[model samples]
Target: MANLDIKIREAELADLELILAFISEKSEFDGVPHLLEATADKLKQTLLFVESPLVRVLLAEVGDTAVGFAMFYASYSSLLAQPCLWLDDLFLQSHFRGMGVGTALLKSLARIAESTNCGRMEWTVNTGNVPGIAFYQKQGARILENIRLCRIDGDAINLLAGQ
Candidate 1:
């Protein structure tokens, strides 16, 4: 941590291009490049102009250089009747990995969760991503073996909604 001067800040509309580049790199790194469909227009619409926005983004910079980003949103746990800070994505450039960037990002997210009175902060790691799993575990996160994530999107999502 001493070797790098890292600062975490909320992303602004002016940082749209930088944020999109990070998202693309992250998608490729995670082996899901095909899933990345984010555009500057969409980001602007959802993150900048939307009223009562459901998502927020954070950027991590190392001495004026943007190295990573984290996108998150709030969720509610019906069973616990408490809010949760859901980390949708956390990614740092390959060169920045193992240099405390990921840890700093998680710490920042934890701070946000605590400040918001969230019951918990949750995120998912790919099963094949050993290093990511290890990093989360190091931060005292538990892997829910019993839980499986499901998703409906694209055509299915619209069809189900009678679109």
Candidate 2:
């Protein structure tokens, strides 16, 4: 189709399979879990949240294929009295790296946040992820020297919810 183009749009239920493929492929490359034990139904549940104003997935497409995606969730800042977008995940396949797709995705997200009056946009990268660090620096994003990120994932959250 000559009219087909590379564009960004909200991810949908139909994108479940393709998005999972990207994550699994990246996980394999990063020596992490390639499969998350996720099913289409489970993905649908997740999509419900993402489709809401509180969360969103922006798909980067080329032709009929999705080459990259950025998953973000909205957070509130009590001090700023404004919503903040916490970028939960950003990924582009190796073949597409250095082509400015990642930057484009991030800039798009920033623009969205700005449009919505959100106070902050944030995410973290592993210290060993050199390219990521460099890119963030080049974008004028600050790298806090002494700060550390803490996480509680998997069964820990369930355990807390049980209380």
Candidate 3:
């Protein structure tokens, strides 16, 4: 049980494949592999090539091996009149779980939020993921039971737009 020196850093364009692999692994872990439609081209265009990427990614590695990633985006809270950091995804390899990698990633995100003067940081977790919920609770995140997530995408978006 040697100490693992985990290093967290902002993702670079060269790490595209590694990021995509982590994303696919996360989707599979969430039991929705079929819903993972992300391609390298899409990731490159949306996350790397954009002038001002709405979404940013952070990678966690132990030495030369990548072990986890956290994807997040900036959001606005009209009521608070301040920016918010919305964590889109946080995933660590199964072997790396409970090894402080997740905590390291979260602490990094918190630092970023504080540095940017964000009003809040938010993300959703599946109710079925008890371990994940517990881990998040340990990290001082409150699980909001009253709020429900809403989404409209794919064909539904077109219909909503009256297209």
Candidate 4:
């Protein structure tokens, strides 16, 4: 691929639709499109319009064409006594992969983590995404072994809440 001028910037309100599209595409790429239930309205309420939004998004563009996005949130590491940047999602279009757009996005995130005095940046990779794992490893991330992610939502959340 040619040397593309990849621009990474924080998402603006005008880019709401673009962000939603990227989220959908990322979900499809992860082979779990059926689990996606995010709507524009929900995103607006929970992420965009909130006074203190927990999640933030960075959009990657090659000129006028948006090629990818990275979504993340801050979490505290009690053990380290510092904040951690939890990368919730990072997705680049198939054509944009290997063109350094992903690397640029990640570099931007690392800057954010550094500026905010984060102890570390953390994310999980799906076992099936071999290429993604390799890419992350190339960026100096190590995959932790013998750790499983657990989740509870929907009815389970309600049941646990004693509803």
Specify the poorest-scoring 10-residue window by lDDT in model 4: 45-54
**Would you list the rank order by lDDT, best first?**
3, 4, 1, 2
* Best candidate (score: lDDT): 3
lDDT tens string, model 2, 1-163?
1333567788877777887777676676556774456566566676644445445789887667788999887888999999998887888887777777777788889998899899988888878888988988887788887888877877898998894
Error of 4 at 104 (Å): 0.4
Question: Candidate 2, which segments miss by more than 4 Å at Cα?
Answer: 1-5, 34-37, 48-54, 158-163
RMSD of each: 1.4, 3.9, 1.1, 1.0
lDDT of each residue in 1-163, candidate 4, tens digit only: 5698889999988888999999999999998899999889889987745899979999999998999999999999999999999999999999889889999999999999999999999999999999999999999998998788999999999999999
Candidate 4 error regions (>4 Å): none
User: In model 3, what is the error at residue 73, expressed in angstroms?
Assistant: 0.9
Question: What are the models' TM-scores?
Answer: 0.94, 0.82, 0.97, 0.97
- Stretches of candidate 1 off by over 4 Å are none
Worst 10-residue stretch by lDDT in candidate 3?
45-54
> Cα lDDT of model 3 overall?
0.94
Clashes of each: 0, 0, 0, 0
**Alpha carbon deviation, residue 142, candidate 2 (Å):** 1.1
Off by over 4 Å in 3: none
